[model samples]
Target: MNPDDFSRVRSLWTHCGLPSRPNGRDSEQHIRRELSDNTASFLVAVDPDETLIGTVFATHDGRKGWINRLAVDPRWRRRGVAQALVAVAEAELRRNGIEIIGCLIEDGNDASEQLFVTLGYSRHDDIHYFTKRDRPDI
Candidate 1:
């Protein structure tokens, strides 16, 4: 994503009901960090008029690829926008020699879970997710 896309991306996330607390981790600072990382991948889908519709962020920790922040405009859901974003991100990761890619879906987010499953991602029950936030109060 380009530097100018930050406001539109943040708006898209808010419109899609994604959690993005102002001045928090999902703020512009974090987005800028991701965009500046040469090894990271960020994809944005826009309409012909250039309005943001979908987005996905992918990163590789040298071995496995991680996908997150997949969001689509409510008006454009189930129309393959999310899938296309994932495809491009995955392709980029593969080009960088990444073999295994994984995504985290919040519990009860059925649409997201099904989207990944339909794309051939298998659920792994053997592992658990953990977080260590520098500022938990946010």
Candidate 2:
């Protein structure tokens, strides 16, 4: 997805129950900046009607590939939309020479955790995620 896709992408995110922190990284400016990253891929899945039904953001920190912001319209869930998005994102990351790919699924999001597990991702309960954010919204 490019900067031109901001509106549609944001709309799809909202429809998929994803957060839209306009004041933070979800804004068009930040999105454009992310798109500029050489290792980043913002992918969107569209239907025959040209409507975006899913999205996934993939990037690597010169080592491990990270998948984030995966979302699929509620109406499209359980139909393989998320799975396809993830597959394509993984392929893009691999194309960039990333060897280890991973994702962070929030606690209590059983569906997402299960999906990742079913896709051959192992859960590491031993690792704890820590983040230092300048602002909570970001």
Q: TM-score: which candidate is best?
A: 2
Give candidate 1 regions above 4 Å deviation.
Answer: none
Q: Which ten residues in a row have the lowest lDDT in candidate 2?
A: 14-23
> For each candidate, what TM-score against the reference?
0.92, 0.93
lDDT of 2 by residue, 1-138 (tens): 868889999888877777667878788888899899888999999988988888999989989999889998887889998999999999999999998999998789999999999999999999999989999888
Clashing pairs in 2: none
lDDT of 2 at 73: 85
lDDT of each: 0.87, 0.89
- List runs of model 2 lying over 4 Å from the truth: none
Per-residue accuracy of model 1 over 1-138 as CA lDDT, tens digit each: 897988888889889888656677567787688788866888899999988899898898889998878899999887899989999999999999999999988899898889999999999888999878778634
Cα displacement (Å) at residue 46, model 2: 0.5
